[model samples]
Target chain A: MLEIKNLHVKLEDEDKVILRGVNLSIGPGEVHAIMGPNGSGKSTLSYVLAGRDGYAVTEGSATLEGEELLEMEPEARAAAGLFLAFQYPVEIPGVGNMTFLRTAVNAQKKSRGEPELSAAEFLKLVREKAKTLKIDADMLKRPVNVGFSGGEKKRNEILQMAMLEPRMCILDETDSGLDVDAMKLVADGVNALRDAGRSFLVITHYQRLLDHIKPDVVHIMAAGQIIRTGGPELALEVEANGYADILAEVN
Target chain B: MALAKLKDDALAARLAGLPASAASGWLAAAQTEARARLAAMGLPLRRDEYWRYTDPATLNAPEVPSAARFEAGDEAPAFDGIDRLKIVFVDGVFDPAASDDLALAGVEIERLALAGQADIHWAQGTYGVLEARGQTPVARPFAALGSALATEGVLIRVTGQATRPIALNYHHVSDTSDAILHHCVKLEAGANLTLLESGPGAARLTKVLEVDVGEGASFHHIRVQGRDHERRAATHVFAQVQAGARFKSFTLTANGRLTRNEAVIDLVGPNASAHLAGAAVGDGDFHHDDTVFVTHAAPECESRQVFKKVLMNGATGVFQGKILVKPGAQKTDGYQISQSLLLDEDSQFLAKPELEIYADDVKCSHGSTSGAIDETALFYLQSRGVPRAAAQGLLVLAFLAETIQEIADEAIAEDIRSRLEGWLQRHAAKGAT
Candidate 1:
């Protein structure tokens, strides 16, 4: 469902290289987890795939179902069924969370030539989806992520994911600021959305999250390249032995 | 030589062309004093310290190019939903055909011209008196000019709680119509009243409103400037608060070629509170200014001034606000904040905030800021599929919501919000992708 061939990315205004010669492939219904250390270009891969600005893609191409992902604006990418759950969800002070969600949903639907949902229909659907994520009505009515706790923000991201229902999802460090219980709640939410027609690329530094989401394939990325590929057992091995053995093994 | 003291050619010519008013006895004496004051002060020139940020050329023009009459029937006039004592004025002339009976319990209302024509009237003591008193610390010659040439006005006095708001609805039907309206309001001790003003009176309009709040009384004033794109107006309000009194005023301005609103407030008694707020949005060829001065003369008083503006294209906004805490006024509290959102590269915001404190035991703070939209928040919204223009509209409304909440009444706040939303919808960019 997604392909990245020789994707070389760099900071737009500087010579600093972020993603160098990165290559990855994920089939439909497959969940791929990338394990890496700090500054290992894991987040860069997700950002480039989602068509974020401020990056110079000097070398290669990334595609989703044979469509050039880099050629679309961020909103166009979202309309084309690519979703990125930010590591740090921004706090928007004025826009209500419910209003923001509805606008986003309606905008995407309009772009795809679909009938827009009525206010009542949108509210009912959002409430049902939010129930699974433990988000109450108060959270939905308040400004988006203004004063939310770390765990609440992550859960809100998952709520958005469920509502949007994108075919390809990229979760960038979703487990970073979450506790064990919170992590399980988020992982369970992700697992429920897994189906034959959808796929996920989960970028994380720890093995605890995979313990819950259970990826179909695992890759070890260092510097700017994915150097190792295995199954769920690979994640367990890193959890037990740490990245030292893996880095040396890959080199 | 005294009459020749008016050096500015434009102001002198405008004053020379005033229509006759049947001012006799004390009313005539007051008008003569105001005329002398205007002559001495001349008109506010662009080089004047207070007028540096906003050029007064349009306000000083003898005859500004008349604006095309606007037709606004999409919805009922702003406060039509609420039951009120509606007094209508068409092109500065009181239209009895369109007005309700000028009768209400707990208040006395009279037209200014009728009072002047009468041999004896209560306006003898208070008309233009408060405005003359507001000339110190800084000179407001336009207010003085409004007092001198205004032949049409309303005089209102309240002794108890008013059951309905006093609404002034202005209708514009002439291109070259110039209106000068002065309103004098006085609330007796333990009284309560609300005054509402709306519509564009004329292409070039000058207005003054003076209010006095007695002990233990409350006064509220809410104004919505009209949406005529080529209209120009200058309005000044002078207010006084006695002990244990409350005064609150808010204004919403949109789509005027030139508009200036000035307010001068005095807190003369302990425990009195006053709050003044405004929100303005202008797009292309619009110049909006808010100049406010607040003084705390009595101990243990509180005052607040909040203003916010959204400017797009080549529109400009100006704010000059000051708060002064006099000596021996202990435990005084004052707050002032002015902010503007510049939607494009060409829009500009000019602000000047000043605070003077003579008492040591006082808490006063002031802040002014001008910034573009939050790019991070913009991207966050855009990333979730909100189009660029829609996201901008959301942010613009969010920025003004804080200032709008300062209104003490929710119903009025909601009315202003809907008006602002309508403007944003109409001005949304074309070819938005």
Candidate 2:
């Protein structure tokens, strides 16, 4: 389970509050969609939850399965069954993708005191997961995210989330730069990883990705706060009209 | 003896007492000239600009007597399966019995002293000079010392269209338990040679190698300095490359108490190329210095210099590289990069890369960076269940892999990698215990 209680976060080195009085809760087997206009603090929520540096938590708390998430390091948060599918993955030159992914996975397992995987076993599992995501075998051998297309990088992020099999996954604008086919493929990868004991919080500005990944709850956020929560119809309503109507009502 | 008290007469007397077999007329004249120069210049002090980073006083003492003869009947130098002509020099004396006949179809591999009589033009033109255009006062002492005590060296000649590579193996072993100097190596026109020079004992040795690359010729020089723990060694390599010729030199210094490998390369002809690369790793109380000077004297010439140093424990390492472009050397492309990784806070590294250009149309750049291993990379590895030591070792290995990637020979590169791993393990264990 994941819980965000009146979370108030600000951009680093500034007094500008980005996420103000935000509250959300999602249980096992539930998919929550957070849709908002530009600068609505959608990506900031993901980063704050992932414990990235340079984000000041002005107030409130984030807890995952009763463990404090904001106080932990990014790597520590990752080891505690939390995964963030970055919108724009960083290109780490000279660090092989397979090497990077294996390190991350084994790091989580090591932190949990799980047995480490041998090279052969790791390769077998990685190849299987990569095949499901349609990533080429040679891509694993290259530097992380180096020379990858926009769509490929997004898909690679999803592939990593799947490989880690986190208990709670955050898909931040996974469909922003993708074409129709790429959007379908990415959504399908996320759908495949969904399970009864796992949760997903898919954040986007459009409803196109939701056509493939249906969510149980839809929340509309504006001015750093979630003002409306409804069933799946809320996504259709925002898609048909836009955020202006919702903004007028919230104001 | 105090270098100030070292008179020409005393030097000449010592030179005269040397075995006749190791003496040559040209060598005798060089010793006289060097002694005269040393007398005029005197020994360099710590205040000298060139010796600022390195103190020559540690090496200054009464000159030890030259060993009478090289200790013979030692184990042969290990080749690790690389096959080429082997020319052996033991204790500054040519070892004909240990040397192979190296009578390839069109190549000739012989001692420089013997070649002086067989082919006077090639030998004299190659080994005649001891001029290093930009050498400093600090280097003057060692250069003068090596020149004053010149002995046998290798002479390799490859005729036109020769396909085989000539390997020159120079090994120095101390039999008289004293220090000795071996000077000069000459490679002739159209010759393709791979010189593998190794010093494999606890004897104090000093050697100077001079190479002449004729027009359109190619030469690859691989020097591995592996001296004993107590031995103090110094190597000076001077190379002159002619039009359209290529000179590639790689030096690896892994063990020594006080070692300096200095290389001076002159691009004398248009379109000539020089590739100079070196890796030096020092542990414990060892001190290693690699100084390189590359001069672009002709238009359209290209030169690259890369040096990497890894120091552990209380060891110290220094890399000083300079790229000089002459006025008329237009369109010259020269690049130099020197990087150092200090494994611990106690280890120290000093890197200075300089570029001086007089040509208006030239692309010359030099950069020097020194830092510890990446902390993020370290944590990334350790988080993956790799023990702390193994993680650190892997990160360090990857850090040096950039330099190793430039090696032309994969097998040689792998061998160097294994040696580096072994070194890391030993040092890590020592640190652990």
Candidate 3:
């Protein structure tokens, strides 16, 4: 479903290198977890794959379903089935959450040559999705992420992931600010979308999130490179001990 | 103090070609006083503190610069969906043939041409009263010029809840026409009225709208400055609110060579509320300015000033707004926000937000910001499959949504939003820098 070959990235405006020759791959219906400490280039991988600005891919290629992803614009990449759930959801002051979601849904549909959903149809679908996520009408009506609590923001991100239904989803620190219940709720939302045709790359530092949404494989990343790979038990090992033991062993 | 030689020359030249007032009685007296005031203040100069960011050359020049009339191309005119008493003006001249009859329940509408001829009229005390009061602390010489020279307008008086809004439609027909209009509105106690104005009147337009809101009266004003890309206009609105009165005005300006809109509001009674908001979108050779002042003279009053603009391709926008809480006006609430979204590096926004509080217990806040589109937000939208251009258009509209939200009517607000969307779509084709 997704492939990264020797992905090398550096800051566009600085001389610092972020991702140094990182490589990863995930098959359809598989969920992979990448765990690392702060400043370990985990977020950079997600941003670079998402086509965010200010990052230069010095050497590497990323493909989604065998189609080159790095060369396409962000929107084109999205249409090609790549979604990044941001660690910190942006707070847009005046754009309503519902409007943003509807626009995104219709935009993707239009780009894929699919007939756009009517307003009524879209509303019904969004309401059903939001209901399971516990997002009420007021939350959907408010400006996107403006004054939203930490849990609400995370839930909103999951809501987007559900609406877009991208084949290759990158969850970058989606569990960072969520409470236990919110984590479970978000995990439920993600689990509901998991199928043979969809895959996820969940990036986090804690094993608690893995407890809710089990991963097929777990990789330990450090110093801009993936140094180790294991199963879901590796996350529990990291949480029980720490990244220090793994770093020491890997070195 | 003697006026500078350059200022004197410009003022003299501007006054030389102006038509003499053919009014009589109270109207003539008001015009006389306005002329004397204009002579003393003179037309604004580039050196003046208030005009520093804007050049007054074309506005002060003797000969009006010709502006080719714009064809709106089959777009339904603004306020077409509303049931209104339409009063049409072609090149600042009242077109009775195109206007609805000046008869409505609970309101009296009269043409300025006819109202000025009457020896005694209800508008007698309102014609220049608020303008004179607003001249203090700042000299709006252009408003004085409009008051003194304008010969076309409408006089509306509301004694009860108006059944529908009164629409003043200005049509531009001649490239060299210099149109001046002065309108006076008086709302008696407990009365309610909404005044809607639209269109680009002429190559050059100078207009003054003075409104007097009596005790418990409410007045709503919504205006759309026309889209003639080369037109030049200077408009002023001076309103006085009595006890328990309400005043709300919102304007949408798009695509003009130069436009200066000034609004002055005085809350002279307790529990009065005044709100002034505007949204402007311009591209290339376009300059729009909004200068507003609100005064809280009584206790427990509230005032809001919200202005937003979207500029690109070297277009320029300016905002100078002030809120003054006078002595003894306790528990006053004043809020002001002015922001601009510059689509390119070349576009510019200049803002001066001021707040003066004489009362000890007052809540006043003002903020001003000018910035490019939010790159992160843009990415967030684009990553959702919205095209880059469509994402930009959405963000621009979102940036201006705060000002549009100030409109009390949902249908009117929707119309305004659609118009803004149209502007964005048209400009998107031209490509943002």
Query: Chain A vs. true chain A, TM-score per candidate?
Result: 0.98, 0.98, 0.99
Scored by CA lDDT, what does every candidate get?
0.88, 0.73, 0.92
Per-candidate TM-score against the hidden true structure: 0.93, 0.72, 0.97
Q: Is candidate 1 or candidate 2 better by DockQ?
A: 1
> Where does candidate 3 clash, by residue pair?
none
Model number with the top lDDT? 3
**Cα lDDT for residue B17, model 3?**
83
What level of docking quality does candidate 2 show? Answer: incorrect
Off by over 4 Å in 3: B1-4
lDDT of 1 by residue, B26-122 (tens): 5677778888888778888776788898888777777766898777767778787878998888888899989999888999988886776666666
Q: What would the DockQ be for model 3? A: 0.82
Model 1: residues >4 Å from true position, as ranges?
A65-67, A113-123, A240-251, B1-10, B71-76, B430-433
State model 1's lDDT: 0.88
lDDT of 2 by residue, A132-248 (tens): 889998889987778999999998988888778889999999998899999998999999999999999999989988999999999999989999999999999998999889889
Error of 1 at A12 (Å): 3.0
Cα RMSD (angstroms) for every candidate in the order listed: 2.8, 7.0, 1.7
